[model samples]
Target: MRFQTITTDILVIGGGLAALKATHSASESGMEVLVVSKGTICSGSSFYPLMEALGCQAPTEDPEDNIRLLEEIRESSFQMHDEELTKIYIDEIRDRVAELPAMGIPYRKMQGGRIPCFAKRARDIFIWEDWNAIRNKSYALLKAKDNVRLMEHCTVIDTILHDDHIAGALCIDRQGSLFVISCRSMILATGGFGDLFEHNLNPSDVCGHGHILALDAGAKLVNMEFIQFIPGFMTPRYKVLFSEQILGYCTQVNDAEGRDLLARYLPSSITSRQCLDERSKHGPYTSSDISRYFDIAMMKEINDTGCEKGFNLSYDPKLLEDKREFISIYVDWIRKEQHIDLLGTKHTIAPLAQASNGGIVIDVRCATGVNGLYAAGEVAGSLHGADRHGGNASGSCLVFGHRSGAYASQWAKSCDRQAINTSIARKALTERFEHHRPNRIDADELIKEIRHLMWYHANVVRNERDLVYAKDRIRQLYEDFNPATHMSNPKTIGMAVKADHAARLSMILLECMLLRKESRGPHYREDYPEKNDRSYARRLMVQSTADKDIEYRFT
Candidate 1:
């Protein structure tokens, strides 16, 4: 099939904070921007915001607020993050948030003060509960930009190369139309591979498109080893609802119902201000030493009391009696937040979802090793090194997305247009589609198996054996991926490529994680329980230097 073509000054792929910021910055700088979406604009991981989330705020009144905030995220990153990149995002975080309200994003506010970053708030800071509203507002703003052209419901199959530099991308519409969008520069704000895990909070659409695209384009990828496994948020009944309640309330539910069921992880000295210690790294309470802080006998008694109480404190309004504001919040959550009936019940959450800690290695300007191509958001591994800070994801995406967009636009303006050749697009996309020729393996079935494989091997707990098993399974999947019917169809081919892309991403990260013997933020190993700064202190990246199978080298 011949390619139908459209050209633009700058091409922004993936529609979220990163893509929106990039497109908007380029357009505001007087460059035409064509922004593409993998799905609806307001979907994916960023769609569900749990309260303020990020704590990137600083005021003259609070002398150490900014430092403290930076310290928080830095700690999460295990001090492995790029200092400049972290600082830049932190500096412009509020600027990004301020833009949201101006764009009509809904956020619960009080006396004109907006919600501050992070789930916790001490005093006069604006604490917001409405996050879906924020996402909608950002979407509205992006939709309103004149220079920005929004193309929803599209998937980029592959890049069309010109003299080895990226000239454009080939995409397929929902109705299976082959549309080639040519541009001098491309910005990939494609999110992360969190959907690789079955129980992740990130939406399923975020299946590591950015990593695969960059790999095919020969861009160097780094830190694929560190996939962040969030510690808190284990709900009993639901299939991993967010630990958002704990984020606001500083609560921790049962861990697979172990630890005597009532052994508290919190230290005896904990107050309202000190509650975060239960969840923090330096926190006195932990899974390894559960009995250290809690009296086992007391814990058993409390567990019995909690059981006799019939409803877990999480849902029971009685627990909130002493704190009416908290009661109101609980009432609102029970009434609005949780879909649970007002009838009190105990909810179970365990390591709710995985967050991506690292991916492709990009520089401060969001440029990867490949020229004429830039990656932002989760795809670009610049901000978070070992583990990501609480609110860094959205903030970094907004800040760097804007920077990458501006740079891409500026570069596109100077480069003279070479007629985009159609041969490259057809060949690249067709070969990709051909891999999925249908004989058997239903896309649905294969996808489910892959998810389970990742959940068992790659998510939260990891050891040498599991990681090895995961790598071998991924290899088998790659081999068995052949389809029998309509094998050469473009739509089928693209979907197959997506599966391959996600699988490859899992293998690459898992391989790197397996190689790293030390335990870090997201890449925890049961064998090496302690964080070993001695050997595995540096950042890790896996690049396909020569062959299809990746080779790892540190960055």
Candidate 2:
């Protein structure tokens, strides 16, 4: 297949808030920036509705206090993050939040004039709106800059490397058009791999494509064992996320037996009602919170029931009746999405993989081990370690996006534009086209198989035996599955690529899980049962050697 080539100084491989911030910052440095996204701008996980308040941490007055808070947050990961990088992430958000108003983005303030801290004591800013305003305003500013260009509906398949440095990237658009983005530097802002799980909150397209790309290019990944599984709605068919606020008001009961399940996991001292009341103040599962046991109970129930059918969430109808405004807002969504009255009826709930706290290994400047390559946002790893606080996800995106952009721009400006790497581009393009050939395996079936295996073994509750079986199964699927068989349709091609990414990412994640022998934070190991700080406290790292053999280490 023929291909087109575009040259730029910096190539940004996402359209989320992090990518936009990077593009805008890079363009301001007088460098030409090109952004390529699988979907439309702001369509990544940034705008996903969480059914709870979403907060972004800004800078606080005291650096030591910020460090202490950040350290506490990283404790969820068992203190596996790089302290310097963590400092950069928590420090840079203050100025970034201050700059939001000038860009037409509003940060809500508390009545006492202090920023709200939803999940932690750190100052966090959030608004009633999801992310439409910030996304729109950021895109407008990017579009206004003459040097910044955006290519939507474009999926980057691979990163083209010249020796150790990034030379360019190969991408395919929705129209099945192939193109090459030749640049001096590349930033991987593609979000996490939540969609790798059978039930996830991320969009369908976020299947760890960036992880596979970086790994294939010999970049190291750390803390892959930590993925967050949050309580989510499944019944009423609305699948609306029931945030901590909503969970507090509901009673957890078995869907079929109508039995209270909290007693199975929580101590006798804490009643089910008390657990629900205490858990409502938190959003996701944090290792430090006593409510995490609630999540463990729900997940244990899910694990026992084969996870096909969800559990029951029953709330007092009078609660909604007391708050007519809340009911009025939800009634419309209930009718439109599920055609059922959610207040009076029992809804199904399950633990769904929501966000990943692990990703590509990067330094304090957000530069990966590979020269001229940078990772920002959720795509970059080692910041959150095992568990992520609620507001830190967006805050890290802005902090590192700004830092990575400036560093990448400086690196790009110092280098001379090299000739287009036609050989690498051609090889990558040919591999993509081969998927369309006849007599290949079905991508849909393979993807479904991968998701089921991951959700069963790699998520929430993981054991050594299950992880080993999953790793072998994923490897076998990767060996037997041929992408070319199901590539007749454009949509199938997309699914085929995502399936490929999911398989590779699963294998890597399994490797990380297997190496960490003790249970820590979100990387729970049923076999080990407890955290072993003596030997497993350090972060685990994995990389592809020149011979393609995987090497593992602890930093």
Candidate 3:
């Protein structure tokens, strides 16, 4: 069957804040834009706001303070960030935050001038009305644009390249129909790889396809080992994230044993109060924090004992007695959302994979090494070195989204149109349908196994032995994958593609993890417990070879 072909000046693959900003910027720059979203606009991880001091770092008049704050952020990333890119982001974040109101985000301002946010010492966090309200408004803005065309329920399978430049992309729409999107420039804003892990806070659709596409197109990816995990709800449905602030107020109890788990792991010298206080500061588990043992204990409990039920987090009712108003306003929302009371109740939670601290390598312009390809938001790497700062992820999305759109639009305007080789796209589609049998592997089963395998071996904690086993198992699964039975179903096909990408990315992540022999930020290893800056301080870079071999280089 001959597939339909659509042409556009710039093709943006994603529908979150980054993609929306990129689309808006590209359209505003007088370039026709086409947005292809796996899900609806603002429906990815960008929609899920973090409770722990989430806000952007806006620029200040004091240059000294800016430098100090940048140093702090670099410290947060474990000193692995691209200095030039960090400087550009630090300089432009305030401007991006300023533009939010115009784009329909109703940021609540406090009494003392600027909008108040939750942060440590720094005060740049701002509260918006809600995710739904902002999403509706942003969707309206994108729909209202005459130059931008939005396609929902579409996934890009392969980026068509001609002579090292992007010619177009092959996509699968909702109805299992394949089509070729011919574009002069492409922007990838497809979020992170949180969904690759079994216990993750991100939506299921974020299966690391952006990294896969970029790698296949001969682009480089960096720091794939550093994924951040935080304490989040495990049972009664995975709806909301357990806030980092809760560590201070709650008691950690092993649900099955009904005993304090931290007491067993932490030294006996420290009292329970001291341990809790230390655990409070290490909510997201930073390597720089001495309290990271709390996180390690949580993981060990689950991993060693097969405690899949996770831990029971409870707070003394007496603690909330004086702060009833604050409890009603803040704590009441979690109860209402989850339909479970907080105080005196053991809310089970474990380390949930939050975000990928690293991703596809990009420059200050959000341009990948590949000429016509640009990446923004979590899809693009080098912004966060070891660990990401609190509010920088959201801010980075807006900042680089604008840059990606502007730069890609300018490239589209200047570059000559490249002719696409239809045979390449045809071959991809043909290979996709090569197997069609009931004896083939189930897409759902494949995805489930990959998710569990990743969480078991390649998740928060890792060792060299487990990583090698995981690599072999993942490679075997990929080699034996059977997408034949569900090839005709678009949804299944999407899952198959993501599963394939997940397998490939898992190998890359394992390799990077094995090479980086130190416990730095989120990438922790039990074998190499110490941070060895003299040897493994630099970032690990990986690129695809001509024969599809992944080659690694540390700089």
Clashing pairs in 3: 55-391, 77-386, 117-125
My TM-score estimates for the predictions, one after another, are: 0.81, 0.89, 0.92
Higher-scoring candidate on TM-score, 2 or 3? 3
Query: On a 0 to 1 TM-score scale, where does candidate 2 land against the true structure?
Result: 0.89
lDDT of 2 by residue, 258-326 (tens): 777777788877788877776776556644446767777777777777755677776665555534333
- For model 3, give the RMSD to the true fold: 3.1
Winning candidate number (lDDT): 3
RMSD values, in order shown: 5.9, 3.7, 3.1
All candidates in order of TM-score, best leading: 3, 2, 1
Clashes of each: 22, 4, 3
Off by over 4 Å in 3: 49-54, 59-62, 109-120, 318-329, 421-424, 431-440, 482-492
lDDT of each: 0.62, 0.74, 0.77
Q: Rate residue 297 of model 3 by lDDT.
A: 77
Against the hidden true structure, what lDDT does model 3 obtain?
0.77
Q: Write the per-residue lDDT of candidate 1 for residues 234-327, one digit (tens) a residue.
A: 3433432333323334343333344323334444555422443334322111223222132222223333353311113233334444344423
Q: What is the lDDT of residue 414 in candidate 2?
A: 84
Q: What lDDT does model 2 reach?
A: 0.74
